[model samples]
Target: MKRIGVIMHGITGRMGYNQHLVRSVLAIRDQGGVVLKSGERVMLDPILVGRNGAKIEEIAKKHNVARWTTDIDAALANPDDTLFFDAGTTQMRGSLLEKAIKAGKNVYCEKPISDTMEEALAIARLAESAGIKHGVVQDKLFLPGLRKLAMLRDSGFFGKILSVRGEFGYWVFEGDWQPAQRPSWNYRLKDGGGIILDMLCHWRYVLDNLFGPVKSVSCLGATHIPERFDEQGKAYKADADDAAYATFELEGGAIAHINSSWAVRVRRDDLVTFQVDGTHGSAVAGLTK
Candidate 1:
């Protein structure tokens, strides 16, 4: 068996803990690792890293994870760890990725890779120079519904695809009566919080892969809720945009419009849905069905 050491950072958060660590990595481990084409078994040995030692330690104990630490530098310094995975805040992802790349570790991180295009490009250049594998997490494309959508597109089910429309998001409680579903930092611009930066990245890949390459875009953003309660139940100003309405022009002459908002209540089939119209037929897909 080939053992691959993965340094997993920010697993304390909701998405990191539930989706990446538990559902993905641990689930893979439970299945006795992955079998390659040559029938070689490859095991992932993960070392969890985070800011809170106590919380991380608790998680490690619960999951039976052997290694847990708060020192990111020490984790990066270890030569045993060949891969570094992060699901942390966007504000810090660029620097963290750069550090991992310089330390000679391959990196896979959540989007947006960086808060700015310059930093994202610079990091890409540096990773190329260092000869390390790198990628941003685009989990939406792997969803069962989207995979079905991709299949339909490939089979020409949507012949001469004319347009694509996407609807996403749900109402997040303001934390006054009910606790907010999302972290408060998601509403603070200083913390790299905004609906546009978060969801547009997903749409970009979804459109390009399922429809065609996006040529240009016109977007309008809004801060639907001006104030919200934080984790501590303290009121804070939610200055970042909670919603986005965007239109994209695909290279193949297909128009794509996506509406994403945290303030909207769901009356649709799913929390998120995409409907594609074509000369031959039309279809709508959700997260699962």
Candidate 2:
């Protein structure tokens, strides 16, 4: 078995814990790893890293991950650990990736890689200069619905694709009665949080691949819920925007309108929905059937 040792950062976070560590890596581990085209079995060995030693250890033991560490520098120094995967907060992500690259480890992570374009570019450039493999999550394109969209595009099912309309939002409970679903840091600008910054990053790749290059964007944002409760039930001012109304012009003269909000209740077929219209056909896709 060719076991790849991956040093995973921020696996205790929501997406990091549930999606990446559990649904992805552990799911693969439970299946006895993956068989290569050459018939060699490739397995994964993950070392969990976080600021909280106790939390990281708990997760590691719970998931049967072999190692846990609060010392990232020590983990990076391990010769057996060839890959560095991060699902940490966006503000710290660039620095973590830089460290991994400098250590000569292959890197992958959830986005946005950084809060600013300059920082994002710098990370990419560093990875390139170091000649290390790197990638940001563009998971939307892999969805069954979006994959079908790509198929339609590739097959010329959409004759001269015209436009795309996206509607995405849900009512996020303030931590008064029901606890806030998202982390409190996501509501603070200093911690790299905003509806536009979060959703637009996802939309960037979605538009680039399915529709076309985005030519320009005009956006208006709002922080609908100003005060929200934290995990400790303490209320704090939400400086980040909870909602955004944006319009984009794609390269092929296609106009896209998207409304993303966290303040609205869902009554529609899907929490998130996209409508792609073309001369030949049109289709609607959502979070679920």
- Candidate topping lDDT: 1
Task: Provide the overall lDDT of each model, using Cα atoms, as 2-decimal numbers.
Answer: 0.92, 0.89
Off by over 4 Å in 2: 287-289
Structural similarity to truth (TM-score) of each candidate = 0.98, 0.96
Q: Tens digit of lDDT per residue, candidate 1, span 108-195?
A: 9988888899999999999999999988888888889999889999999999999999999887898899988999998999988999
Which model scores highest in TM-score?
Answer: 1
**Least accurate 10 contiguous residues by lDDT in model 2:** 263-272
Q: Which tens-of-lDDT digit does each residue in 1-289 have in candidate 2?
A: 9999999998889999998999998998999999999999999899999999999988888877878899999999999999999999888998999999999999999989998899999999999999988998887788777777788789998788899999998778888999778888878898888898888888878998889999999999999889999999999999999999989999989999989998786777667789999999988887453
- lDDT of the structure predicted as candidate 1: 0.92
Instruction: List all candidate RMSDs to the true structure.
Output: 1.0, 1.3
